[model samples]
Target: MSEIPVTPLLDTVDTPSDLRKLDQSQLRQLADELRAEMISAVGTTGGHLGSGLGVVELTTAIHYVFDTPRDRVIWDVGHQAYPHKILTGRRSRIRTLRQGGGLSGFTKRSESEYDPFGAAHSSTSISAALGFAVANKIAGKPGKAIAVIGDGAMSAGMAYEAMNNAEQAGNRLIVILNDNDMSIAPPVGGLSSYLARIVSSREFLSIRELARKLARKLPKALHSAARKTDSFARGMAMGGTLFEELGFYYVGPIDGHDLEHLIPVLENVRDAAEGPCLIHVVTTKGKGYGPAEESADKYHGVQKFDVITGAQAKAPPGPPSYTSVFAKALIAEGERDPTICAITAAMPGGTGVDSFGAAFPDRSFDVGIAEQHAVTFAAGLAAQGMRPFCAIYSTFLQRAYDQVVHDVAIQNLPVRFAIDRAGLVGADGATHAGSFDVTYLASLPNFVVMAAADEAELVNMVHTCAMHDSGPIAVRYPRGNGTGVALPEVPELLEIGKGRIVRQGKKVAILSLGTRLAEALKAADILDAKGLSTTVADLRFAKPLDVELIRKLLISHEVAVTVEEASIGGLGAHVLTMASDEGLIDGGLKLRTLRLPDVFQDHDKPELQYKEAGLDAESIVETVLKALRMNSVGVVEEVRA
Candidate 1:
């Protein structure tokens, strides 16, 4: 393997205190070095790229000015914290960016003292910062709390709520609105237009200054009228007048890229700030780099790539990804049915719906990081005799759980949920893993839950959700490529609450759920070679489980094993509930459950993580064999391979 490159300036700096020692000119150099290091690191590790590059100078300025560890600096969403991590004593281990046992891709409070409040989701920084500000006030501490949030994050309702509450509290707080004109996807909605008006009006600052000066110099008797006139004119010139009404002292829409403009404005805001303050800084996404500037969204989160050609490291040829399979199936179904429409919260490309959006522009909706709004919007469409598919990642869907239960489940709307990343995500750590959706969604009253055995089954699930108008239906799938199966020309909907036994044997029966069917098949093969015949059945639906088929297997086979990709309170737990309710345990049928452990799994290769969790084929076979041996079935000395 080639040796890693060295970073000199990055190596020398360990903390924000070390950054404070550098002069303004050296700080500029440090910003350049930081950007280069970020690009280089992401080129190897494949994570968020453009946002970090855009915020390089801003990050440097903040660390240089603020006394961090004393004055808390919170990053909203934290996808842009790569530069912050490199400068804060973590440069040496930067290569292991999102790997297991390595540095987190986002800010983690447990990782370092510099990260006071950790965040992986968006629009949370302002709320967290406000909490710190309130706590500091109660403790009588002389500390400043600043929240650096992107323009896109500011559109969320929670952010506005924090701003309103912070203004009412009358506490000293700073909010830096980084206007980059991009989220993971380009920002949508009315807030985006308001920000655009502020950026386009170049002469807003000079005009506001002249009006303020004129208003102050007026006669004492007519001062109130003069102040009102100034406020009206200022509102007309700069578009941030709405913020003033909310009780926040509104500052500039300044040039963020220019250090000369940013440094002095920030210094003034830090010194003169009393109540809540908002400093609007305009910056370009992927500011300095040519390639990233041209394709900001493509580079938002990436894999290892060649810097010169900007080509990502190629994976060995595999089957179509689970996302592509779903997209293709949805498009096929859309062609057949005109009433079907698709919606995504902020992830069109990530959810593989970009092609569908292009083909059916009028039918697709990109709702922009608002999962709750997306679900309710889908519910509205479903109420009007339209079939709506709301495709979102499992982790992000957690944000809208209440909406799903109230708007969709309670109403029994026929909104189709296409949940992506339904298992252990390889990187991005615990915050991004899709482990809890099964347990959480199953608890809701009127919902149908299903999981695909493979890529071909995922296609059928899409067709099933599109056709089923009985109630809300959800299909969960994993990340990465599929099993290279030949796809069917037409999708066929399977019977609901029914399961198929793939391999029938006499001794033991293995019932698997979702993507873990392949592991069960492998374990069956291992047991077969040992003269211990194993039956494998795919329990397609988790909510309304095939109770009849499970009872038949328990009666015919001596031992039964339940396997699932979720945690303890998931499919396996539901099976145990069924057995206890049906009084199947009194029949002398031995049962063992294999699932992801209760604790959170750290970042690692997906295969290695499964092995460690004892959910792999070898581990499953070992677990089942041990159970059989303990039940007085003679232990096999060796399985014939």
Candidate 2:
């Protein structure tokens, strides 16, 4: 383990209640100590570093100023809530971040009461906080709901939608916009700090309330003009016209790192008898740590590292990540065709659209944290002569399901959906897992769904998607580096709805989809060693099942198993449905489907997750053996080597 940082003040505080016991003057030391402890903890555990570091003082201030648990505080996208977690009595498990049976990478309600509303996806805090505040109000409870949301999260429409309906929450709802990336206003300084403090003060709000009452007694025209003037003055001084329009009493552009500035303003907002308020707090992404401050993205998500040198552990050199291969393949396709374009929902780097954007700036679009818009935009592009590839994570693509169904699938538009993270993502846990894309996309009409078994297959699929113009098509691939297979120099445009047989055998047939093909091959080898000739088929397309091939395999093989790195309703379900439709199950053929379990899987190593899901080689072999034992055909007599 790395040397743990000394945090004298932080050691005294087991929870936010203990934190509130200290004198106001001692908070600076507490904040400093808290920041150091967080850095140390994240250094050991290797989770989200930059985001959590950015909100140290803000976390401290919110806990100090507000009565938490009673006054619920929800952190948007919760990746930045590590410091919040530390303050809220999870410090002991802080080092176990993102590990199996450990602290989750994001906020989880089951983890603590401090996390009133759990979140992993962006732009959901405001809406959730509004729900809490409204529920409390209905119950006649004395509590506030504070939402600390990043400015980047504000790019999504859901945040604004919640803000628009926040008037009913009254003084119970508070939104602190943590502006780390987008500088929506001038830099925070003495003037901005003074303005934030003054505007959020009780006296100022009282005076404004009196003026509003006075204006109500005036003529309709005068009252309207008075309201406009008040809005204009605030808009000019603080640049909160947009938020003001959304029915929030906007405050700040305050320095989030400054404990003194944040505490008083937050206290004022807490006590203010107004409708829902929006406070814009500006802070650096990597606020305090030297290494993180210097290179934000590198330290954003890291591996266990040397704390002193800020050197992260590096994985051994291996094959390129599936994301990179897809990017390169997309770029190659773009070079061949001018109409080919790309779109991503604020995850350019994660989805490999960053490389595409760099290669063809005009043809690529980073549509912010708006997956719905990205899908529809791609649909629009496809409706025209241009072919648009909407590259999004499987988890996030859920946000645009309505658009996928209504706009793309229904219209039969030729939008290519490059779905990344299509299976269990180890550290990110259940919320970030891509376990349902195959099921969801395959179920849609006018949609062709495919999954890549390896890097070369991914290249071919990308080429296939590029050339495909029949309707909405998607290719799903898992996270992390590919299986070290040599990538094709020239990508092949695979035939739609077709699968290839990898090995030929007689008794047992393994139907594999996505990255589970390697495990299927291993299972086949194990079965072959046991004198059971096993056939391994990489059924690339989850939808449009290769009827002839599947029927032939089922009729020829005594036992057939379908495996996928997805949920129960995906490839397995589809294969079962096809078998039933074709009356292939009546011939005394034993069949089984291996997929992710019905329950939501927790954060763990991908291999362990797959094993637990019974999608690993050993699990596959066990499943096949179990199936054979249950068979009445006496296959045990033919098992001799």
Candidate 3:
């Protein structure tokens, strides 16, 4: 085991109450200890490191200044709440962060009383804090709601909507804008810090308000002049005047790293009787660690690493990842076609669109954190006869369903949807898992939904969607590496709404979808060894349902089973509905469906998560035996074979 970091001050603090017991002068040392502790814990556990490191001092200051548990502190996105976790009595288990039976990567309301609200998605903190504030006001409670939102999250419209409505809880709702975004980082050059001080000062706000009121009372002709003068002056004075106009008493552009600055400002904000205050505290994404600070991304997320050398431990190299395959495939198609372009929602790198961007910078569009706009923008591009592939993680794509339905599907635009992370993503937990995309997308008319069983299939799907001009088509692939299948030099475009039988049999057949084909094949082997002839078919298109192939299998095989990586309403449901409608299953053939369990499975190793979800080979074999009522064979023993 590695050497655990020494933190004398941090060791004394079990909770925020323990932190508040110390003098204000001791906070700097405490913050140093806290940051060190967080680094060490993340070094061992390997989760979100940079975001939490950026907020160490801010976390310390907030916990020390405010009475938490009583006063709700909701962390936006919750990846940056590790320091808060360390301070809030969960320090003992901090080393187990993001492990199967340990602490979650993000905030969970069940984890501790300190976490008043749970969050994994972005831009939800402000709205949740507003809800808490309004509830407290109605109940006449003494609690105050504080929302710590990041600058990148500010790009989403939901945050602004919450801010606009926060005027009702004057002084009760506090928004701390953690400005770590390189785009929105503090203004560069010419005494920016000094200007921030001047703007945050009482005099500047008073003068700005006086000017606004005077302009309102002035003649319409002169009102425009006054407004322009005020805008120019305020823009020159403070960068946060835009937030002020949106119904927040804006403060700061303050230094987030300095405990001296953060502590005092936080204390004042807590004591003030102001409603809906937004404090813009500028912070570096990776504050203390040398390698993280030096890196372009600040090492936002990392695997387990060497703390001293900052060298991350690499996983054993295998096949090219599904994301890389998708990128390469997209780039190949883009090279062939001039009209092909790509759009991503804030995550150019995560969705592998950055590779495409590198090749086709003129055509690639990164629309920031706005998924809603990304969908509609792709629809517009497609409507104009351009083939626009909108690549987004499946979980994140849920935010733009309205746009997908109303803008893309309704209009039958040929916008291609590349949904990455389309299954149970480990470590990040259920919030990040892409479980419902097939269910939701397959139901939409004029929308073609497909899930890839391997990297080769993913390439075929990509090529197929690129050529597809009939309607909006989506291809969802899992989070990790491919299944080591040999890649085609140029992918063969698959016929839309078609499936292929991988193995042939007579007694029973397994219809597989997504990446579950491998497990089905394994199960087939076990079934063959048990003297039960088994057939397996990979159903590529979830929406179209390859009805002809399904009907033939249902008639030939005495038992039929459907397998998928999604929820109940996905591939299995579609197959069952199609089979029933066609009267293919009325001949008393046994039918079973394998899917993720009804409950939300917690974070674990991917293999273990699959086993728990009953989607593994053993589970499939067991399901087959149970459905067949094969009492003659030792089902459990046959699976062991």
Candidate 4:
């Protein structure tokens, strides 16, 4: 085990109150200690590292300057909030992050009062902070709302929408644009810091306010010209012309790492009687750590690691991840079809669209953090006689539901949706879990939804989706590695809405969907030992139910169970609705549906999560036995080989 870094300055600070008690000169040391502690804690627990390290000084300055809990500070996306968490009385449990029954990796409202709003997804802090600021204004309160948003998150339209409506906050809303990536402005230096200080100072703001008052008396045309002149001059000095036009007093392009630069600048913005302020602070991701600074992704998300060597623990070699398989298959498909193009929304690497993009740069599109635009863009591409595959995580696809329904589904476009991370994500918890895609997408008209049981099935499904040009089609696959099945050399275009029986029996029938097929097979072995002949069927499509196969199995078998890895209103709900509509339940059918629970699940190991959700083999056997009215277990020494 690696030794934890010494954090004597951090040890004394229990919360932001303790941080505020320290002298201004002591803050630099505090920030260093905070950075070291964050790296050490993340080294043990393994969560987001780069973003948090980037914002160490910024986090300290904000908490020190603002009266937090009373003054709401919302960290956008919350990947950079680990340092914030440590400063807000969570340092002791920081090492337990992302573990089952431990601290959450992102900011959670339930965890502490410091976290006014919880966030895991990107591009939400500005809107949430606006809400907080408006509520305080309406109540005639003294609290300010500060939103610390990254430049990457700014690509989303929602951030601009919030900024456009920010004038109403009236000196209560502060937006700190953490410019870690995408250097939107010239390099920050002494001159830029001096300019930031000058613009944000109370005297300069008061003079500007007087000038604005004096200009109002002039002709409308001159008044408008005067306003543009002031904005344009500042825009030239600092790269914030767009922000100035959006009704914000823009002040920055300052060094985010320097406490001297950040503290007074934040204090100035906090005290200035402006309508709203946008502070552009520049910092490097993985600023302090050498390994992270030198790495390509800046050691963005890491596993439990050695602090001294900066070496992460690697999992034993196994089957390729579902994401990699999908990427390879998409690349293969793109090679065959010239019209086939791939699209992703700010998740090229996560969804494996980066590989596809590398193969065919002209045909690939990585529209930043804009899921809605990505879907509509794919729809447009499909309409223009091009085959477009929108590769996105299932959880993120929820953001573009309106586009999916209005643009693709309504028009019946042949756009293919490659939904990745189709089920529970172990460390990211409920916010990232792809629990509702099947329910949402499968419910839409002119949409065909399919789930892959394994890597081979995923390959076949990708081929089917590529050939599917009648209407919108989607294929969902899980996050981690696939079951070690042989990949087919030639991809097969499977018959739509058809299911295959992996094993045949008479007494018990298990209808499985997605990755739960393995559990179903395992349950079959257990049932067979109990002298109950069991059957397992992998029903690939969720929207177009395998009517003939499902009906045949239901009528023939005494006990039938539908198993899927989705939430309520997914495959299980659809199956029940079908049985009810077809009068298949009139004969007192002993049918059961197994799926994710109604409530949100917490972060845990994948196997434990499945076990807790009652989607494991033992749970399947128990559900089957309960349905069969078998109260007592009958153990048999001799089992079928």
Candidate 5:
């Protein structure tokens, strides 16, 4: 790792309060060092790179001006918190970020004194900051509360709702609208354009000042009417008059990158602001870095890379990732079927739909971060006799749970969900883990949930969902590269609710779900060498489980084990429920469920996390042997292939 040049101003500053002591010129130099440190650290750790780099100056300015420990600053979506973390007494631990037992990638309340409110999901900062502001008021403590939210985050309905409530409350709050013109992808919908128009309007200030002066000089009774007229005039000229109507004192269109502009604007707002104010600060997404500025979205989050070349370190060549496999399968399916279409919520590239979008531009839709709209939009398309595949991350899909239940499931819409990142996602931590989708979707009516055990199975599942026209179907796959299994030339759809027994044995049976099949196979081999033959079955569908196969296994085997990569309420829980409902446990067959525990697992390498959770080959072997009441076998004992 290349050593970051330690500047005198940055060296003494261990926390935000320490940063407050530095002069503006020194702070500017510190900002440069912070950016360099962030780029270098992320180049080594491989995390959300560009967002943090963009916010280096903003973060430094905020910490310098604000009271910090007393004055709460909430960051929306938390992706831009790397610099904040580094400045807030975590400089030494910067390299350990997103690693297991290390500093989290996002704003974590437990990690530092300065991070008063933790956030990962978008459009939540305003609401959280308002809550803190209200509490401060109640406590009779005079303190400033600021919410630094992105233009992309402003699209969510929750942000509007919070703004409405904050306006009604008339609390002293500052909302910094970070107008970066992009989220993970280029922002979508009418709001994005409206914001752009309002921010870019050159004549807003001169007109607003004249109107305000005229309103203030009006008679007391006519003041309200004059203010309304001023608002109407502004509305006709600029689009953000809707925000003015919401009762906030709207300010800015200031240059967020220019320190001279930002410093004075922020100071003025801080000194004179009484009610909730929205400062629209325009900033470049990837401000400092040349390559990042050129391709902001591509550099939003990156793997370990060369700082000079901006090229990611070469990874070992292997089988295609599950995401790539799904994308290819969907594209092939779409080519075969004219009605088939694909949709993603601002994540076409992340979801591997870039290829699909290229092949069928008209058929593909990038809906932005509005997950609620994306699900219902897919439903609307499905209602019109179109086969819509809503490709979304499992973590992000949780945002549209209500929509999924109401619009898709209750109506029984044929929307195929290609749920990527359906397991422990390393580095991004708990906020991005694909842990709860299985549990949430399984409980919903008319929802068919399936997990892929490998790349081939994922392809098969995608093909199956595309072919099925009955109801809503979801096929979830994990992050990272797949098992090195050769894919079938022609994709084949498997029978719905039918599971295949991969390995047959005499005494005990292990029923696996998702991509943990290989681990189960390894466990079975380990057991077989110890004179305990184990049967392994891959339960394909979680919703309409193969009861007959399960019953047969329960009757034939003395012990049954259910394994999955999901949380407590997932595949294992469903199996236990089925056993209870069928009264299968009356036969005295011991059942053990192995899945992710209730507590949130820290960010670690997927294999390491699996081993830690006792879901790896060795752990699975140990679990099975212990369940069978067998002695610990020697590690050197080899099983016949």
Candidate 6:
């Protein structure tokens, strides 16, 4: 093992309780050490760097001031909880973040009592914290719920919804709006401690009480006038607040980097609030580190990088990634059709819409973190006879299911759904995995759900969606690189409900959907080697269900199998339903479906996750051999061995 760097101040602290024991004056040094330690940990095991760095001082302040584990400190998105994890007795295993059997990248209730709510999806912290606050109020428990949410995360409607209902949660709720995007956390040239002390001082409250008492003695007309003047003055002075309208007492846009301001402000909010309070702490996204500070988004989610230079380790160059393929393909189609447009929900870069946005800036819309609005907005564009490709990660697309069902699918609009990250995404675990999109979308009427087998197929799918103006269509693809297949000079539009056979044989048939076609072919090769004639078919559309092609495969072959990178009730389920309805199962025909397990899986390498789910080449072979009751080379043993 490499030598761990000496962190004297950080090493002295094991938990938030230990942090509380230190004097107020020593907190700045502690926060400094904490930031260094968090950077070091993330450098070792790459995860969210900028967010965690941005909140180092705030995390330290919250822990130092609040009685956590009892008083729930719910972190929104948990992207900024690396420092919180280090101070909460998970320091020893912090280096194993996002790895198999390691500490999770996000907060989890199972991981620690301190993490009262588990979160990876944004805009959920305020709602979860409100729940804790209300539950504590009912139980008469001493639990204060503090939700530390980023300003970017506040774009989601759920945050505003929670804030609207916050009064019911009583005064035990605190929301620290980490406004890091605006680069507002500037250093206070020595007056920080004095200003913070003045706010937290008892004289401030005495002045408030005295003013209220003096106001009560004034005549009714004068009192009303004074109250109006005070509200107006406060609004003018504080610039007003939407959260205040929602019943929260608005506080500063203070320097989050300043420990003097953070400690006293947090102390004041902890004691003074009899209703929900929102403290807008403005900080830089990537604070302290020169590289991270210089390039905020680049360091937001980094891989293993050089600590000194901040140069991330790049993956070996290969075929173009699925995301790039979709982007380029969409760009080509958009070049041909002026009506084509792109939309994303706070993930312009992640969904590969950045290039499209550049090419057609007028047509591309990045609806910041608002999935529901993105879906309905795309539907509106489609209704106006425009080809709107709403590109969203499958996991995030789930958030707009109601809109998809009601506004798009039900209305039968021509909205094209470019569903990226359509399978288990490594290092993000089950919450971020795109497992259920097929089930949800396939079940919807008038929705055509298709998945690409490789880069070439993805191009065709993009063109197909662009040309087809019948109803809503979805094209799902995996996260990483595609098979090194040669690109077609020009993409051809695929038939709506189609399955193309890559290999033709007899005895057994392996039907695949999405990127699992390669694995199905590999399984077919194994079956052929075992003296069993096998066929491989790429069932492109999960929803349309190529009934005729499926019947041909089922009738021609004694054994049939459906392989998909989706959960139950997807392609396989649809096939089974089609086959059963057609009475194809009455004969001695064997059928099987291979899919992701029902349980939520933890983060690991993509290959390992596929292997674990029994969706890999070897697993396909094993499943086929087991279904046939053939002891040819003992499939499972040979693969496992």
Candidates in order, TM-scores: namely: 0.91, 0.98, 0.94, 0.98, 0.92, 0.95
**Poorest stretch of ten by lDDT in candidate 2:** 630-639
Ranking by TM-score: 4, 2, 6, 3, 5, 1
**Between prediction 2 and prediction 3, which has the larger TM-score?**
2
Clashing pairs in 1: 46-302, 46-303, 100-603
In candidate 6, list every pair of residues with a backbone clash. Answer: none
- TM-score, cand. 6 vs. native: 0.95
Q: Taking the candidates one at a time, how many backbone clashes does each contain?
A: 3, 0, 3, 0, 0, 0
Residue pairs with backbone atoms closer than 3 Å in model 3 (clashes): 170-275, 171-274, 171-275
**277-320, model 4: which lDDT tens digit per residue?**
99999988888998887873838899988888899999999999
Query: On residues 1-641, what C-alpha lDDT tens digit does candidate 3 reach at each position?
Result: 24688888888999999999999899989888888888888889898888888898899888888899899999999979999999999999999998999999999999999999999999999999999999999999997899999938988999988988889887788999998865665444335545555554556556766777788898998998877676556555666667767778766677887776667666666666555788888887778888877873647888898889988888899999999999999999999998999999889989889999999999999998899999999999999989999999999999999999999999999999999999999999999999999999999999899989999999999999999999999999999999999998889888889999999988879999999999999999988898889999998999898999998898888888899999889988998888788886777878898888888889998899999999999888888888776543744333343
Overall local distance difference test of candidate 3: 0.87
Q: Model 2, residue 222: what's the lDDT?
A: 100
lDDT for 291 in candidate 1 is 78
Worst 10 residues of 6 by lDDT: 183-192
- Candidate 1, residue 174: Cα displacement in angstroms equals 1.4
**Global CA lDDT of candidate 5, please?**
0.83
What's the candidate order when arranged by decreasing lDDT?
4, 2, 6, 3, 5, 1
Alpha carbon RMSD to native, model 3: 3.3
lDDT of each: 0.82, 0.92, 0.87, 0.92, 0.83, 0.88
Q: Candidate 4, after superposition: displacement of residue 300 in Å?
A: 1.1
What digit string (tens of lDDT, one per residue) describes model 1 on residues 1-641?
Answer: 11244556656788888888877877777777787787888888888888888888888888877788788889999988888898888887888988878988889999988899988889999899989888888888877888999937876778887887886434357888888973322333334434433432335444655766776787875777876665565456544676666666666566666665566656655665256777766667777777788898887887788776777777898899999999999998899999999999788998987878988999999988788899999999999999999999999999999999999999999999999999888887678888888898887888889999899999999999999999999999999989988898888788888889999899989999999999999999988887889999999998888999998988888889999888778888888899989998888768889988888888899998899889898887888778766322436455447
Off by over 4 Å in 6: 1-3, 183-202, 206-228, 632-641
Query: What RMSD, rounded to one decimal, does every model reach?
Result: 5.1, 2.4, 3.3, 2.9, 5.1, 3.0
- Which stretches of model 1 miss by more than 4 angstroms? 1-11, 168-171, 182-232, 630-641
Q: Give the number of the best model, judged by lDDT.
A: 4
Which residues of candidate 2, in runs, are more than 4 Å off?
Answer: 630-641
Model 3 ranges with Cα > 4 A deviation? 185-234, 296-298, 631-641
Candidate 6 lDDT over residue span 1-641, tens digit each: 12266778778899988999999898888988888777777887889999999998899999999998899999999999999999999999999999999999999989998899999999999999999999999999997999999948989999999999999987799998888886333443335445545544456756755776799999999988876676566555443346667887666667788887778778887887457888877788889988999998899999977777788888999999999999999999999999999999989999989999999999999999999999999999989888999999999999999999999988999999999999999999988999999999999999999999999999999999999999999999999999999988899989999889999999889999999899999888888898889999998999798888999999998788999999999998999889889998888679999999988999999999999999998988888788877665834343353
Q: Model 4: clashing residue pairs?
A: none
